[model samples]
Target: MSIRKRLSPEESRTAALEAARALLIETGPQSVTLKAVAGRIGRTHANLLHHFGSASGLQKALAKDLASSICAKIADAVIASRSGIGTPRDVVDLTFDAFDKEGAGALASWMLLSGNEDALDPIVDAIHDLVVELNEFGSEHLRDSTLALTLMALGDALLGGPLSASLELPRTAARDRAEAMLLGSIDQAGTLAPEG
Candidate 1:
């Protein structure tokens, strides 16, 4: 029999994480058993445990990986929103697009349902940065604007398609209204930022 090539600890961990991430996006967190991930990565479950210390460790690492990817997209959206290059509608559309395209909405739902609340920290931190940007831009009520925009975009990602089909509304009509309202609020607050 031929000897198998050895994988370094880092390579093994990365391979396992990539497998877990793909599985998470495809079947949700519920399906990410160590055995499944190990099989997907062509490693033994013990090998994974050796690297991760335990199944919980693997899940935690996977959650962190997923959150980081999702958070980066959100951060980019917030960066765009801060720039003032795009209108409010543009910001809203980009936010929803980022969530939907990444399947982040579903991934988040699964991770939270799986009792991995730690998964949300990175995304929360990213949003915090966005709020700070809005505050610096002269938003009178940073809390309200952040809450409204975030909830609106997330709702749109989760329900926009089905709602659009049921109402016979254009897929983007609701988003358009929400964006207009978001812009209206910002306008009412006034654009004191340099970009304006």
Candidate 2:
């Protein structure tokens, strides 16, 4: 006797999102299509439409999931950065690592929403909420400074600028250089405290 195969609605939704993510990473968002997602998951286009309504719906869901996942990592890294058990250099390093995972997703999602003002507003608002929550624990001055550095580094790396490659230097070397620069600035500003 031949066996029948079936997937629950939730399972199908999950599988579709997984396929969408794979496609996004493999060929960028331009290649994402409901037909492709369904085919990749051994389902029909009609079945995909039934679950997600439209290609855009699936893409939206994928973007939301990606944002949530990336934010979780950022939260973890931010906690480590706050402990003072590690230096600011360590914070910068972890921020870069977090961007490496979520940067592309955020960029793509923003680009998509930008062309659709209705979607753009809500997504940006959500991101702003996340950012506010994530940095609330740190001093406003330090939080702002850290966010500025993270954004600058992220932009530089994404743009492939000459100095951007420095972000990929050996971890120890990068940390030492960053720490030296940070401490040097503090000393120059007369903000450095004497050894306790």
- Among all candidates shown, the one with the greatest TM-score: 1
Clashes by residue pair, model 2:
none
Deviation in angstroms for 44 in model 2?
1.5
Range of the 10 consecutive residues with the lowest summed lDDT in candidate 1: 66-75
Candidates in order, TM-scores: namely 0.70, 0.63
lDDT of 1: 0.70
Give per-residue CA lDDT, model 1, range 1-196, as digits (tens). 8565699989999999999878866786666778999999888989998988866577767656654665465556555675865456666766676456545566566667777767566556667765674466555555576677667767777798998899999998767877777777766666553664
Residues 1-196, candidate 2, lDDT per residue (tens digit)?
8443699999999999889878877776766789999889888999999998877777777766665665555556556555645455655565554444434434454556546334333334444655677544333544445446555545543553344355675534434454565455434433433334
- Model 2 Cα displacement at 167 (Å)? 14
